[model samples]
Target: MIYRRFGRTEQRISVFSLGSMRLVNVPPAQAQATVEAAVAAGINHIETAQAYGHAESLLGEILQTLPVPRQQLILTTKLTPQPQDQLRESLQGSLTRLRVDYLDQLAFHGINLPEHLQWVLQEGLPVLRQAQKEGWVGHIGFSTHGSLDLILEAIQTGSFDFVNLHYHFFQQRNRSALEAAAQQDMGVFIISPADKGGMLYHPPQRLQEVCQPFSPLEFAYRFLLADPRIHTLSLGITQPQELQTAWAALRDPEGGWGNVLRQVQQRLQEREQEHLGTTRCAQCYACLPCPEGIHIPEVLRLRNLALAHDMTEFGQYRYNMFGQAGHWFPGVTADCCTECGDCLPRCPEQLQIPDLLRETHQLLHRSPIRRLWE
Candidate 1:
């Protein structure tokens, strides 16, 4: 397993960190086996959150029986931004549940709105600072599903040691946030790369073809790790097979995956160009602020992938998440587009904005699915 120094924290974190969200509904024995397999495969960093049902307690029970010493593991947990008075109780509860005295990192989980940031800065941060002073926490950070502007603002505060956010092959809007985190020397951990990275775990045939010699899932791993700014990709595994699949992708064989990585990337671009021509969504967010609250760039991008790469399932999965995901994926579907011509004048590509929205709605709309987080 490849390990990288997690920015200013100086902890050598495995490129593949275990995320415990998927294990919430799994049996304890299965969860323990999965965790044990990950540790055996050299994944030192394991993260869980209080919101994940029974995950902390399950991990605590497993950790005690593992042959590996506690010091060798880098354990992290998150708490929702809470009242100052509730902070101690929340932190202590997490620690007690995880069978640990101090946490490697404690993040303000899901600061996805502007108000959440305000709470973190004014109220949440002070209590975390006190926890640090008492040696209850080793480092402080936050996980966000907010906009790029909000993420940039949070990094600029210089109060965080690390950050957890989403950045993958299909969603590159947060690329600038990765750069900002690097500038601050903050540890950058990607959230849900496999499942959220265009649902590559069960990728369409066209996507598999474009990513030749590597499965779409493997390609996603290589794509993220190519950028040194990314410290780790959180793998939310419910079974040991998932971890093995990811580990196999990380292995360097003979001449290595470098040549194939470039080829696969070029093929992916070329395939999209074949169908999209020049009208492909650049994801520049220039066509934003839709009058009806549509996420134009994301919807159009999903449309591009679905039409060009046969990623219809991925499109449906995300498009259906419009109203269901709340702030985590804020926006209505293109069915809400009012065609005000407001975004038309702003677009640098000068594509017919309303027409594209209508097409997107036609191509990807589906019955809403329950958000995995919920």
Candidate 2:
């Protein structure tokens, strides 16, 4: 596996870092096997977050069993910075959960909002710097699901050591963000290059054509890594087969992408539609002022993404990370819709409000959510 310098840090992060959020959240034994396979395959970087249920704890058990030296590993973890003061405690708690003392990289988790980034810079970064001084964290970074504009804004900060953002064949809006990360000498880590499980199986034919000579996965990975600014790619691996597949795919990417494209063509049929990810919600949020305190736009965004991109887990992740926890100052759910039909006109997509709400409610509260939370 090729490794790259993670920003200015002394660590050489693997091009493929083990993501413990998805696969292992379902079963500890399966998670262990996946990590073992990655380690045996020469993967050195392992990333998880304190909020990711028991994935962190599972990795700790595996590390103790594996004979992998502590110094030989590049561990990255994150903490949500809402109650900013709790950021320190969160980092320490993640280390304790992972059975590590000092995190190789401690990134601010889930700052998809520009105001949040500003809040983090003004409030959280100082605490992060203090952690650095205290030797609790080696480097600082953030993982985002925001627009390219917010990403560019974060890159311009000149503060973060790395940038963890999303990229996929269907989603190239962040190309500029990748460029800015390179210019700033910050490590650009692509999170969910497969569109949060959307591209893993196969992508639409039109997308395939644009991403010619590449699978949705390879096209996404290569597209992001093509930028010298990018340092590593992280996947939410859950099984040993996936572990082996991603590593093998990247070994010689030039040819593998084409192979993947052919596989996509053989495996899935393509359908054409304009407003690919926006037919439902587009996340425009133009329909604010809901009498009930529900985050209609945000919920719709996840729904459209879940269906449009086939991100089977994104709807669950969004609910787990946002809904279950009242992180939005005040959060809302589908039950609040009241079938009022008031939001229809304001919706840019004019999606079927009640029907979509029913689906969103079902997806958000599904039993499988336990898979992501362990």
Candidate 3:
């Protein structure tokens, strides 16, 4: 596997790291085999979280049987920033679950709001600091699904050694945050570059045509890897076979891969121009702070994907996540957009914001049961 300098930590972390969230529901033997396969494939960095159900415990069991020493691997797990009294207990639980004496990295999980950040600074950081002092935590960082402004605020604090956020070809909203993290020399780990990064695992035919020669999933990985600012991309693997495509992408000769990346990007741009015409949303957040608390840009982007790329299924799935995702996705769906026109002037494209929102809602709104299942 390809490795990169993980900023100030200075570890040569694997560019393709294993994310344990998907392992929580898998059979124990399957989970163990998957972890073993990843380790054998040189994925030294493993990320998990206390919030991911039983992922930590399952990974802990597999790690015990690995041939490598515990110190030879980089292990990271997360916990939500909690009340001062509950912090150590939470940390101890994670340690016990992972069967580790210490964590290579411990993040304030899901710092997705201003209040979450405040809690981490006031109640959480102190506990993490004590854990660090005791050598139970090696580095402190945060994982976020917050707005770019909030993420930048968190990084600018200079309180972290690393960060995990979502950034991919389709979801470039966090591009500025990635740049800021690089400027701070903090390790930038991208979350969900595949599934949430446009559902490339089951790419629509149009996207496949645009990303010729490479599967949409491989293209997504290459797109992120091309940016030097990104250190690693999380692969939420449930089976060993999922690792092969990524390994193949990594095996490409550097120069050849660079050429392919450029070609794919050019093709994607051409496709966008052809399919979206002039009425497409640029994904600029200037139209934000929606008076109705609707996430205008995200909902419209989902609309564009459905209309432009004929990715209706993916678009519907994501659009329905609005209310369900809570703070992680934040904001109401397009159905909440009032005809207030407050966002119209802010939009550089001069698109009819409310009308488009209504159209999006009509196309992608799901029943309560369907949303829950998804």
Candidate 4:
């Protein structure tokens, strides 16, 4: 595997770190097999979080069955809420599940407010320090998707050893944050690179063309890691195949990814044009479980993806959504929306819900053939 020095640390980290968040509800065997595939492909960095729901347990089973020694791998996980009891419970539970006694890095997860950083310093620091002192956690860090201002403030404080931020094609505003972390020589991890602010999902064809010459994963990984500030790229690999693909992508030795960076940037610009001043529902899914069984967000997302990416995939997914309505996603019918006022204000964007429903209905019921060419 190709390795890069982890910030100022002597340890070499893989460019692509395996993330286990997508394995939510997956059987332990599947999770374990996924990890084994990644490890076999030379990925030594694995990242996960407590909030990922049963992921730690699934990972724990995988680690126990691994044939390699525990010290050979670098595992990173998170603890949120910062309460002593909750922190302790999370660590112990994670340790028990991973079947390991220690963690390479245990970061305080999802600190958005500046006050939350203070909470970590006051309450969470002691616990993490104790864990480190006792040999339970090797290092401490925090991941934030909050304000860039707060992130820069926390980095300047230098209270933690590592930080994870969202940086990608669509959101390049965190250069200052990366610079701040670099000033202290702390490890910086980038999250959701492909979907930062939902930019990479159904990017314009120009963007797709930029990456068509190479893997979009490569474009993202190379772009984020080119600066010495980034130490790791944690990706949520759902299946074993993705693990293998990432392995080869990161290990490409010429240290180049088909030289598509500039093209991809140009493509991202065109893809960005369509959403310049349009209003959009953030897809928070808070407007869920419609009493009338309207699958509002799913239909909207598929429609958005159709308009954003290739309609072929959207048509295919819609076909499946229709074919397996009661099976794949139970009670998510497009026809079930009753113009009810229930799911309206929950949206932070204040989109016209009834109009959106009309658009979604037409898209879903439209001929699949036309959708493919559109």
| Model 4 pairs whose backbones collide | 60-97, 60-98
Q: Which regions of candidate 4 are displaced past 4 Å?
A: 195-206, 244-248, 251-259, 270-374
State which candidate has the highest lDDT.
1
Once model 3 is optimally superposed onto the true structure by TM-score, how far is the C-alpha of residue 332 displaced, in angstroms?
1.4
lDDT of 4 by residue, 1-374 (tens): 66777765456887778887877656766777778888887788888887777778778877877787888898998877656767777688889877789999888887777777889888888887888899999878889866667889888888778888877643465778988988988888888665433334444464356466555655666666666778777777667866544554555535454455566666644553464224444456677767876666656655554555444343344534443423223344466677888888777667777787677666656442211111
State the displacement of the C-alpha of residue 287, model 3, in Å, after optimal TM-score superposition.
Answer: 1.2
Pairs with backbone N, CA or C atoms under 3 Å apart (clashes), candidate 3:
none
Higher-lDDT candidate among 1 and 4?
1
Question: By lDDT, highest first, what's the ranking?
Answer: 1, 3, 2, 4
**Candidate 2, residues 252-326: lDDT per residue as tens digits?**
655554554455544332321333433545555667656776677767666655555455465665554444544
Q: Would you estimate the TM-scores of all the predictions?
A: 0.97, 0.70, 0.96, 0.70
Q: Which digits, one per residue and each the tens of the lDDT, describe model 3 over residues 227-258?
A: 88988999988899999878767766485369
lDDT of 1 by residue, 21-85 (tens): 98878888899889999999999999999988788998988889988988788888988878889
Cα TM-score of candidate 3:
0.96
Where is model 3 more than 4 Å wrong at Cα?
A: 368-374
Which candidate should be chosen as best, given TM-score against the real structure? 1
Clashing pairs in 2: 23-238
